[model samples]
Structure formats: C-alpha cells, structure tokens
Target: MTNNNNISLLTAILFFSILIPLFLSSPPSSSTVSTKTLVLPLKIQKPPIGFLSTSKASNSSNNKLSFRHNVTLTVSLTVGSPPQSVTMVLDTGSELSWLHCKKSPTLNSIYTPLSSSSYTSIPCSSPVCRTRTRDLPIPASCDSRKLCHVSVSYADASSLVGNLAYETFRIGSLTRPGTIFGCMDSGFSSNSDEDAKTTGLIGMNRGSLSFVTQMGFSKFSYCISGQDSSGVLLFGDEKFSWLGPLNYTPFVKISRPLPYFDRVAYSVQLEGIKVAGKLLPIPRSSFVPDHTGAGQTMVDSGTQFTFLLGPVYSALKTEFVRQTRGLATVFEDANFVFQGAMDLCYRVPPNRKGFSDFPAVSLVFTGAEMSVSGDRLLYRVQGMTGKGGDWVYCFTFGNSDLLGIEAFVIGHHHQQNVWMEFDLAKSRVGFAEVRCDLVSQRLGALGLNT
Candidate 1:
C-alpha cells in the first residue's frame, strides 16, 4: 500500500460519485426482465435484551465461542448500453456496487462500454429502489427508471453517490438472478496517476442491500484464501466443508439504522496478555466494551492488519517492545518492530525465554474467546501508516465516524471464521468458530499481503 496505491484506492472511491448518471436513460431489454421472485432461506430476527450491551451476561455459563471463516466475493460491474466488466474492490464496509457510467460529467481514467446492450437500469419508482433523487443532486425530470441513485459513507471521511441499476454481477460460480448496483457517472479522478486502474467497488457488509441480499439469498459466505488463491463467495447451498468449522456471532443492529441498512455491533474483551511466558500486569478491567463507531473491527479481507483503537493499540505496542527488546530494533517507519525490514518480520532469539515471551493476543467475546499468535498480531502490511510512531495495527475513526453505531468490520481478507447471526426476536448474538488458514489462502490470491 504505497502512497501511490492508497491514492489510487481513494480515487476509485471518489470516481463513482460522478459517473452514475449516464446509463439511466437507456431501458432494459424485455428478455432481461426477471420473472423469478427471490426468497432467502435465513430469516432476519431481533436481538435479545442486553444483546449488544457491555454489561455482564446473566448466564455467564451460556457464553460460548464458535468458529467460521471470512469469505470474499469478486463483483464485476459493466457500464453503458453495451455493458463492459470493470474490476473493483468488493468491500463489506461499503453499501453499494457502482461502475463508471457514460453520462459522467468529469473523467480521468476508467472503462466505459461501447455498446448499450450490456447494462440495465431499474426505474426509480421500482419497489426495490431504496434511494431518493432529492438526496442526490439529480434533476426530478431524470426518469427514475433511467437513473439509479444511492449514497454511501465510509469511516475515513469519504462518501459516494451514484445511480443504481441491475446488471450482470458474477461471484465465483454464482451469478445473481438480477443484480442491482450503483454506477458512478463521474467523480473518480485522481491527483496521482496510479488511481485510475480501479473500475468500481462491491459492498458486502451485513444489513447491506448487496447483490447477495438483493437476489433474496440469505446466509451468504465466502473464503478469502491468502495471496495465492482467488477468494470465493459462496451463495445459496454451494457448500465447501473444507472451510474448516463454521462459527457464528450475532449481528447487533444500530440504535439508529443507516439509510439503506442496519449497523452490526458487538462487545470485545481485552482479557489479559502473556509476555515471555509470564502473566503480565494487564488487567481484566482493561477490557472495556467499546460501543463507539471508532471501535469498529473491519472484518476486511482487503485489509492486512487487524487495527485496534488507541488504548489497545498503545498497550499492545508497548508490551511487544518491552518483552522483545533484545531481538527487536526500532525503525523510522513510525512503528515498533523486531529486526526485519520487510514483510512485518520480527526476529526471535534462539532461547527458551524468547519463545516463552512471544506475545499472545486474545479477543474475548460475550461467550467465546479468540487469540492471535504473537507472530500474526505483530505481522505488518506494506504501506500502512501509524500514529505517534506505532505500527498501524488499527486506526481510530472516532465516535463521529460511527454516527453513534458500532462497527465490527471483518476485513475482506483475514485468516479467521467470522459468523454474523442476527436473532431479532431474542436480541442475543451467537458465537461461531473462525478458521485462519482458509481466510489467509483466500486473501492471498487477491493480491492482499496478509
């Protein structure tokens, strides 16, 4: 993630805001009209009392840990009358999938289709259309059927606006029956030259009206293999038992839901730590429940590092330096480190104490607990920035970013099973197992250096 790459990623996001309007004027072919109605198997449920609260559980014995792996689905969006496939980042943090459209007012570097037959736009009045034209700057005369409008905000102070449409969207072996996404008419120009390569983005978070949800499919999962194998998003019953064991966590709804979807919330416990094979002074009281937006854990396969908030970030870095001082060397990279220059390498001395002192990071959930090996937690990704000379383990977006809702982001790539089960009626979240190897393999193939 060089400065050039970061700018490119940002540019791609900004471009969608401008290019969504051009394709709205065209009508869909009669053959493209979908006659099939989609019905999902999983039912949306409510949460139980104190489901997302930080208070102690009444039945502490009921707390259990489950495991599951995070999955990635590649989304391709084609723009214009003759649609063309565009490569984009499928992000759960985002809410819509949009491409560069023909009517874009501003242009830089992007793919536009030469033929009009490839893409289709859903009318504004369509029952599924969740956006309003007034929200966007679109003129009232712009036939809603021709243009699709949508709004999306990110933790990093970035926002997107574009038109929505139904186009051919493919993920692994599954092709959505009739996919609805966004197409940016313009806005994605970049100050840096590298920003132009991206085509669009795909949103895969819970509570999103993504292609998976729009097609009326429930219980969608995928595996993000490490940098070697292309990640796959499983749809319907396309099962893969090799995904290790499946684990589930409850999806906490936001007190105030966003325009297009609900927010996912959860509690995390800092528990304790093991340094040099000895119990450290870390306190259980140090484990406070984070309900602010800044505490959002990005379950993103697209991201390599597991970013933590300010307090956790500081404590982890300090302990790593204290315990591994002999083998570690401070670098100008603004983060603590062992002795390696590249690939987040940390040198471990050949001694019993060295091995015993290895850092063990744990995450305590309501009824379950998970740990990150010292090596993995200390692993670093290229081009990540840190604050006050610390490695970029996680970032703090502050409470404003969350808009008073909590964000537990699962990176598009990571080696863990992340299950999100929402029981609306009981308001209680469940825990599942997370498989690491599967997540590593999936993310590795996508060029993410996790």
Candidate 2:
C-alpha cells in the first residue's frame, strides 16, 4: 500500500513536471490576428416552443432561445489547455466573456479549470481584476482565497457568479491566448431548459474587456440568416468575396456621463421611421438622447425583439395600426400580449394565405434605411386560436419602456438576411441585404465547417 502511494505521488509529480514547460511556453500567434480576415460559420437552433417569431451561430450548430423572453445568439468555440468545446451566446449588448464552471446545476458540459493546464486564475491584487468591471455596473469582488471574482446580471435577471481567470479560446482556425473570462460556478437563468444547452456568453461590444477589443480586431461582420438556414461571422478588416453594396452609418458617441445609460453598447443615429412609405409624426427629438444619455438607439443582436422608446414606439404603432385597419381584425385584448411584450396582434382570415399586403416598415437612420417587409414585419405566434386554420400575426416591434430601459434597441429579429459590419477603425457600421445561407456555405467551403 505504501509502495502504491509512492507510485501515485510520483505519477502526479511527473505529470506536472512534464506540463510545466507547456504552461510557461508562449502560445501560437492567433490566426485572427495574423490573417487579414478570420471567418467562423454560424447556425440557427430552434427553441422548445418551436416558432413564436421571437427576434433573434457557429460551425454547424448555434441555438437562440426565446424562452422567458430572452433571445440569445450563440457561437461555438474551444477553450482551455488541451481545449474543451464550449457553447457561448454572442451578445453585443454585453462587454464580458464568460463560461459555466463544473459546479453549475445543469448536467450540460462545463469548463473545468483544474483539468486545464493553461487556466490561470487572476489574483485579487492584479490590475486585470481591479479594472475588469470598468464598463459594467457590477463591481468585482475577492473571495476568501484572494481570487478575483465577478458577478454578472443581465437585463432579464439572469445572473452568473464566478472567479475571473485567463484561458485560451479557439474559434475556427484562430486561437486567442490568455483571454480573460469569468469561470462561473453558479448561474441563474429565467429558463433552465434552454440555457442548459449553452455553456455561457461571449460579449462582442465596444468595451475594453470585449473579445473583439481584447483580440485587437478593428472590424467584424455577421450575416444572420432566416429561421431555417445558417449564417457566417467574420473578424478583421478584409472584405469577403460575396459581399455586396453596403450602406454605412457612423457610430455616435455619447460623451455625457449617465449612470443608467449603457455607454458600451453600439449606438446609432435615427433620423425617422417610415411605415408604408409614409413618415410618422414623431419629432426628431424623440429619437435623440437626453442629458443623461437615455433614448439612444443600439443595434443589439442579443435581444430577440426590437424595442423603441416609449413615445417613438407609440407613434410608430399608431401609424402602423391606422395603415392596416381593415386588412385584418385587430386583436384588442390588452391582457393577451404575446410573450408579455408584443401587443399589436391581428387575426388573419384563413382564406388569406399570408399577410402579403401588410405595409412595409422602414427604420430610417443617418445615411441608411432598414426595411422590414412581409413576414419580417409580423410574426406568426404559435398557440393563438387555431380554429378554422386562422393564424394570429403580431407586429414584431415592442416598447422599450416595458423592459424599463430608456433606449431604443434594434434586436435580432430585424437583422435576418442582413450583412452587418461593425467597423471599429472607422467608427461606423455597414449593412446590406443578401442571402445569409449562401454566406454560410461559402464560409464552410473555406474549411470552417466545425
């Protein structure tokens, strides 16, 4: 028994002795950094309830869940020393990357730092720990072990708590070493079933701690496909071969210090909104931010539905309802809001095939206009009076006041079939209409299938 114990101790020592060199060795230069462009494939995964028209990654699989009114856009990446695969939601509204630790409740696969030779915990005294929460409202705390810990809480009340650490992240052929992320041991979600499928989230915002900013990438682009197809994600400045004509809009910077407003999010200017080729009566000031930086418009892929500021949304909805009064019966039940947010529902007659006659809604921005037409304007919500094959279609736009947020958010639902380029170098965003599935195929052909 003593001989066996000696042998076990020696084996443990030998394992570390062999791996010590690897831990000290510098990582390979990231392909995302060296290459002019890095492309990663993305796919759309349906939720449990199937299709509710909720506005919404990755190799061959990326799932976005609309459960509990939270829409998440996910991507697949490998992490750690030997590299374990992890599913992370791509959130432009947030500024931090994180992963679920082994102690999480769900039986899904999680990151086990102890098994990773390259995982390095940030000490409480480290500068990285001190400024980790610079862009976030939450502050970093130190545990009894003197390890830097962070707690992240989203707008939906989903929270994650864990130690701050550095690990290697590999996306497609690119590898980013010593990337800082939260190794969350505890997580709380509004819906466990849907959240269980994903390990954590990857923040792609403009903050200092964001993945794109940390990796030193000046530009990134993504094409979000429709419900039935895949898409593509690209990092760096090199343009893709298939990219078409794109309209550009400069990013607006809010220098005003506002405690409640989100400064890290991508903000864009809104000139006006048009419905059925007619402009609404809302004043231009309604779209502008106040002294506190409230009422800014952001393009966030994390949110499933588009949310306009209270007055702006009201004006748009009023104009929209007036335009389509006789086409379909208005669903006027105030208590029957679909998913507790979308209230402008209409019951279409079974004889009518689809809402083809619905007027197109266009969001006019500075130097750019996004047109939402046909099925994209209205979502066919499931389980809404199925008698006689009559379908219920609800307007995709919602009020941001319902979420207690003062800003206008352009969600994932409206980004489908659009090539969106977030250019950091020029401080501008570019958008163009194209088939995202074709983009996905092109990326897959480039050997980014996994």
Candidate 3:
C-alpha cells in the first residue's frame, strides 16, 4: 500500500539540527570557480506511511494505496576517488553533505573509504573540527587517521553519526577536487534499504559547509515536477534563453537565534495569503518575524507539503473551504478517514472540469505573489480511499503546528512546475510557472531542437 504516513516523520521536516564544527571555512571566489551546468536528475521518492503523502518513483503495487501524490526530490552523485556514483536526496535545509558509509562503491556498493586511494581524514585538532572557541578538540591523536566526528539529529529524534573527511566529488562531467564531506557509516535507520531515500544528503543551505557555498556558486536552482520523476538542478549563473521570464522576492534576514539550530534556511517576508480575490484573516506576523525576530518563514525543496502556522493555517483553510465549498464533491463517508497530511481534499469530477472551476490560491511574498491555479496547487492523491471510493485530488496545504512546529514550510508539493531561482548575489528568490520537464531543453540538454 502507498504508505499513508510518509517515509519518516523526519522526512517531511528536512530541517537539520547539528551540534558540531564542520570542515568549512572560506568559500572560494566565484570568479575563480568555473561556470558549469550540473544536471541534477531528480527522483520522486516515496514517503513511508502514517505521515507521508508524496509519490515514489517505484511502480510497485503500492501505487494504489493513496490517491494523494506527494513526492520528494533526490539526485545522483559521484563521490570519492575513481568516483562512486550514489543517489542522494537534494536537501536545501541541511548544511553538511554526507555519504552512507566508508566503502568503495559499486552499482549497489556501500562507500568503503578504506579501499579508496584518494581517501584522507582531517585531524581532530583542525580548526574545522572545533565548533566553538576554547572547545575541546575531538578525541583523536591529531594524525591522518584521527578524524573529527559529528552527529546530526532531526525533529523526530532520529540521528546519524559520521567522521569528517575530504574526497573528490563529481557532478555530470564537472569534478571538484578535494571536496569536504562526511564519511558516515551508522544511523537510526530501521531497514537496510530504508535509507534508499538517503544513502546520503546533499546539503544546500547558506552555511559555509553547504554544497552550494563549497562550490563557490552565488546561485543555484531546482525545478520540481508533480507528475514525472524528472527535473533539473542548475548551478552558477543561468544565462539560458529558453526558460522565459522570472519574478522575484528578496531574501529576508531578520535574525532570531533558533533554540539549538543555526539560521541557515532561505527566508522571505510572507506578507499574506490570498484565496480567490480576498486575503486570509491571518496577520502577516503569522508568517513573519516577531519582535524577537523568530518565526520568519522559508521555502524548502525537500519538504513534500506546504505548512503554515496553526492559526494562519486555520484562517487559510477557512477561507479556502468557504470559496471552494461547491466546486468539487467527494465521498466523505465513514470509510473515508483523513489520514493524509493535507487536510482539504476533494474528488475531482470524472470530466476533471471541477479543477478549472475551483477557487484559486496565491502567496504574497514581500516583492511578488506566487499564484497557484487549479491542479498545481493540489496533489492528485490517487487511492487513499480504496478503488471503490470516488476521489481524484487532495489539497497539499496543512498546519505545521499539528506536527509540533511553527515555521511556514513551502514544500515541493506547492513548487511543482515552478521555476525557482536562488540568486545569492542579488539576495532574491525568483519564481515563475513553467513545465519542469521542459527544463531539459531550457538548459539546452537536448541541443536546440526547439
């Protein structure tokens, strides 16, 4: 069955909580960095049950489980000497990019560092190993074999441990020599392939340790799709012509120290949300920083659904239900239990005309508004009700407070077919509606056939 709950509760909240110093200092100048187009072929990952709603790339029988189609993004990478290609999740909220283990990789191989000629560990006494001033150095003899260690925890109490090390990293045909990363071997994973979604995590936050900063690129972008398992991850300046025009919102930096986590996520002033032509009753503060500068909202690619603060979500849902009450009808019987993360769902008419006739939803950022129409704003949750039920689509918006947190999370579910550009130099995030599958030609991956 399609797991009703996503793969892991932690999967929906890709937010990282780290308590160690990493091997990242100064990022090399973008001028010194060669501009390269690294194609990040995104895979549609299936979330485990109970909390999961996204779709998986697999075509197994479980496809009939939930009609709700929620999906997470992942990409393949070549790590270590002689290059071992491994598929990893592309996480914009995480800071450190790590591998599954220390081994030489095969098609299905674990990363065995002991077998790689290019393997070398950074010492425990290194500056990167020390998280804070006067902190004790990691327990090691200060030698090549003496590696610094780090532990990463998620909101669900699941955790992983790894040692800091440097190895050659390659994407497409582009190779970065001596890239710093974690050589991880163990974690709180239950099944062996349970880690298939994350043999490793490719970090894309603003921290110095992130894959984006380490590569010295001031900008990067990923276009995610709702229907297909394919999309594009672009790096450096996008001077391409095929991708059409863009809209932008300045990145917000109202500083508020999170309890035990660094403020490394990409935040924006989410002024308000609009349903149909009317604005929701929630205050802008519901999604913005307070006097303490905490609670500013961010958009994450790894998270599968859009999350709002509890009260803000209530206002949004109230307005949505008010506007879309008669647009589509579904079987809301005793057999139809609300198990998916998205609270608002409907059975699209067999003609599918109900979607086009439905009310619209839009998010007003400080500089621009992201207007989502019909099907794009909702997920077509397939079989959450059995084959006997009448349901076609489910809305993807939900309250994050229900999950015990309150950060406005704009996940991939809402970003489908949206071209998002993260320009660090301009300090803005640009969004536009485009078919993600067309991105290959937009990047000229297929040669100018259009």
Best by TM-score: 2
Candidate 3 per-residue C-alpha lDDT over 1-450 given as tens digits, one digit per residue, 9 for 90 to 100 = 000111112234233333223455432221244665555566667654434334431223443232222345777777777777677767775666777784422224467787666766766766766542121112212334576776665543445677777776777656666667777766764223335445577778676667787777889887876656677787777566666788889888645443322256676778998888688777655776555444556777766667776788888877877777776664343233232235566666455544666677899998888877776666654434323344446566776665555467677767878888888888889988888877854565431211
TM-scores for all candidates: the values are: 0.56, 0.86, 0.80
- Against the hidden true structure, what lDDT does model 2 obtain? 0.67
Better of 2 and 3 by TM-score: 2
Q: lDDT rank, highest first?
A: 2, 3, 1
Report lDDT (CA) for all predictions.
0.37, 0.67, 0.61
Candidate 3: TM-score? Answer: 0.80
lDDT of 2 by residue, 73-182 (tens): 66888998899998887767666678888755664868889889878888777777664444444567689999887776544445667887778888877777877777
Lowest lDDT block of 10, candidate 1: 1-10
For model 1, the stretches where C-alpha displacement exceeds 4 angstroms are 1-83, 102-114, 122-161, 172-178, 188-195, 227-229, 238-244, 254-298, 332-357, 379-450
Model 1 error, position 159 (Å): 5.5
lDDT of 3 at 360: 79
Worst 10 residues of 3 by lDDT: 1-10
Show model 3 residue runs off by greater than 4 Å: 1-21, 25-32, 37-40, 46-70, 102-109, 131-146, 190-194, 255-262, 291-293, 330-341, 347-354, 380-383, 386-388, 444-450
